[model samples]
Target: MNIGLFFVPFFEVMRMLFAYTTEKQLVNARNATTGTQYYCPDCGSLLIRKAGSLLIPHFAHSAKEICHGMSEGETIEHLNLKQMFYQWGQQTDQQWQLETPLNDLAQRPDLLNRKLAVEIQCSSLKSTRLAERIKGYSQNGYQDWWLLGVKLRPNKKFTSLQKQFCSFSKDKGVHVWGIKKDEISLFYHIYQQDQHYQYSKKIWPSYSVPITTILNTNLSELPPKIILSKQSVLAEKRRLAKRLSCSEPKVMKVQTYLYLQRRHLLYLSEWIYFPSRYSFFYQEDLLIFRLLFQQEAKNADTIFKKFLYYRETMQRKWIFHRIEEREILERLYLEAIFCQRKAKIL
Candidate 1:
């Protein structure tokens, strides 16, 4: 239900620090006696205790052995975060397993407790792989929580991969969590304006805050209302007018389509230019959607059916898989109604 972030330095020479004994006893390389033997929890291979001034005390496989528990060339930041979470879990008296392998799911999450699987992603992951892992968790009745690293942090504009990491909740709307040193932050109420996104954030001490409390915290506030003033609408119109004069291909395509319907880009219904907070979820042009809806401007059912068609046809791709279609349709319908009411006053 919530995502998180963390920042730390990447170590070129890395393995895993957390390992288990033949008898399944958990061991940290830092506390292990030198020359004593430790084995990988997942693969049961002998592990070498690694320690140095620059490196965090950890464990490494004796050789390049294949094991899900050990990530090759793992970053020091990743290991530190795992230790922080593991220690926090212990302090909070929560049963947390570090680098635990889920044999049933054919995966090893950074941390696992009950039905929750936490993945601390510090490196780039392909979109297909991300989707597959998420699906694997869902199919096996486990909840997947992804915590982003510094390299994958969201910006004013989101990349496709960043959007894929987002999760949704009624309290926070679209949200993510980021961790930096001892502080953990929740970025919520994510909305879009034109090409960029806007969001609000709250931070807490990572170790001091109870994990359950942070996960369960609710703002209980409504998502920000979508308000388009005349000035704002005029601003968009002027920008579009400028682009049209320069004959930009994408802008011209929309202009030509409007021309076919005897509509001009700058002179059309003001409602068509109104931006939706959920616009980021849409891949099809919102402007074109509004234009089509206006052309059918008879009743709610007609508009709803048209919207349903778009959903089925994949004209709009919902990045957050957890969001229900009904919520999106209902909110957009209400937004259109409000725009219509405003248009009447104008």
Candidate 2:
């Protein structure tokens, strides 16, 4: 027997079997409910049980309800927009209010910062109404409003109207105004149905920002922040010595370590490392690592161990000496990898 093929089917069968077991467990858990029967935790709606061969208990409302009817695929897109707004607010030293009411129009943006109103429009709306709603933001005191339209097969006319809206906002006093389209299909296909906003993050320039600015940031200023930590700098130098077949480290301490200790050194490193990982091959693995380490590290040690396994791979020989070094160096390498990955993925 071909072992590889057998293992392939074995894994597939195991996956399906696990899924089946899980679904059975869920059904049993749901049927044995201690309390309410029809309510969904997601949107606080009365759910009607959906029958299917899948065995998992699926529920739907009699009528479509906002947020309640969102497919499993869309949940992450919504969560990602929420998370991005949150991260942007933190980095920019701004506050993001969720579900905050706007002017008397009762329009509540998904996220509202001091200068910008961000709406995560996952559903289609009339083009005229959409334009009017955004124009209303300009009419109000919001100087920079962004409508992130998450749609499946966005209408060309809608895209054109969005461009017109940006132009119109420029004519007005608004400093920044734009519509970002996050294609649901792209998210589905590219991310392999993973629930985070990887697709949106990858194609963000298409919808959120300009491509040139993204490239410039990647090329000019996204490196040093990612790969060369204080310990990793020394490790890298040591690695170079072995590669050059010399006793002395090719890159001096002044070149590698002196600047590495500076308070703003990571920012410089970002500029150096960002360009290399822009290729397609490194992009996915890099992104997966970043998603794993986000918000888990307050200091260098915590960040490094997160993706230490990848460091062990011989493929990264171009970067470091033996992967098994001091814990501190290992940690630094992981952090650098994360930074490089995040810049590309985000």
| CA RMSD of all predictions | 6.2, 22.4
- Compare the candidates by lDDT and give the number of the best one: 1
Q: Rate the local accuracy (lDDT) of all candidates.
A: 0.72, 0.36
Best by TM-score: 1
Model 1: residue 183 alpha-carbon error in angstroms: 1.2
lDDT of 2 by residue, 104-163 (tens): 544545566664766554444455565565657766766434444445223322233332
Backbone clashes (count) for model 1: 6
Give TM-scores for every candidate, taking all chains together and pairing residue i with residue i: 0.80, 0.29
Question: Which residue pairs in candidate 1 have backbone atoms (N, alpha carbon, C) closer than 3 angstroms, thus clashing?
Answer: 3-177, 4-177, 5-177, 5-178, 5-179, 17-59
lDDT of 1 by residue, 188-257 (tens): 8998875568888888887886765676789977777777778768877887888889998767766776
Superposition TM-score, candidate 1 onto the true structure: 0.80
